[model samples]
Target: MRCLYCAHAMGLATCPLGTVVPILNRPENADILDLLNIPKDYEVAINMALGYPTESPEPPIRYSDKIKIVL
Candidate 1:
């Protein structure tokens, strides 16, 4: 994640307003719209329907040929 709003990374956590604000989850209507004051130009990288995973996904099998360095 980019440290744009993180005070610890920027060394401003002690400042008055630099203390971070929490964005609360909003319901699915006009209330959510007001909560998220996203600009027109902004875009969401990921949007998820949050829930516990019923099954654990296995890691992909790695191929040995891909490990060689050409240089």
Candidate 2:
């Protein structure tokens, strides 16, 4: 999986418009809302670290439609 942005994980209780601060000046233990001074109900997407397959993966069995011009 790849890394994704999550406000809650970043110490933010709520984020508006899924906007996450590129840089936070508050401590890691501090809540993101407290740092940003945002009201309640604010939410932002989550930043997550995901690991994808190291090697190329084959397509599913139903992918035959992708071959429009078969030689």
Candidate 3:
């Protein structure tokens, strides 16, 4: 999860920020893991596809305004 987050941050830092799509468990993924020689004991965390955006959308409004800070 940490690695995925780091990769996601880097991907988003591009000139035209790219989207990071996470791929979960799939039968073909097992073959890929084997090809990469990833140990069976270790599970695949995330498979991300980074690419430019096709459509531009407004950023979601964060609800941080509602959170109260306790000093």
Candidate 4:
């Protein structure tokens, strides 16, 4: 998870390891690769979105009321 340069950069300044999104929806979208000029030998296994949060997220729903717990 730690590449030499990545570790170095992170050490120098906190690199917000942003949200990791998958290319599941558009796996076959070669436009991204073309845009980036990525060679055919390589492939995009994962994707990421980096930015500051716009607002606080909604609270998670509690399953306690919905699903019966069986111990």
lDDT of each: 0.40, 0.43, 0.53, 0.51
Instruction: Write candidate 2's Cα lDDT for 1-71 as tens digits.
Output: 12233543444343233233433323462487666565545543443333443454554566566755453
- Give the poorly placed runs of model 1, Cα more than 4 Å off: 1-37, 67-71
Which 10 successive residues of model 2 have the least lDDT summed?
Answer: 14-23
Summarize candidate 4's per-residue lDDT along 4-69 as a digit string, tens digits: 346445443223332332452256766777788877667665444334444545646578688765
TM for candidate 1 is 0.28
lDDT of 3 at 16: 22
Q: For residue 25, what is the lDDT in candidate 3?
A: 42
lDDT of 4: 0.51
Ranking of predictions according to TM-score: 3, 4, 1, 2
Alpha carbon deviation, residue 41, candidate 4 (Å): 0.9
Model 3 Cα shift for residue 16 (angstroms): 18
Residue runs of model 2 more than 4 Å from their true location after superposition: 1-41, 44-48, 63-71
* lDDT (Cα, 0-100) at 20 in candidate 2: 39
Please state every model's RMSD to the true fold in angstroms.
13.2, 12.6, 7.2, 9.6
Q: Write the per-residue lDDT of candidate 3 for residues 1-71, one digit (tens) a residue.
A: 45555654665422321232123245556766688787877666545455545565665656769965453
Identify the superior model by lDDT, candidate 3 or candidate 4.
3
Provide the lowest-lDDT 10-residue window in model 1. 18-27
| TM-score for each model | 0.28, 0.20, 0.38, 0.34
Could you give candidate 1's per-residue lDDT for residues 1-71 as a string of tens digits? 23333543554322232122222222233354355775434433433233334554564556756775443
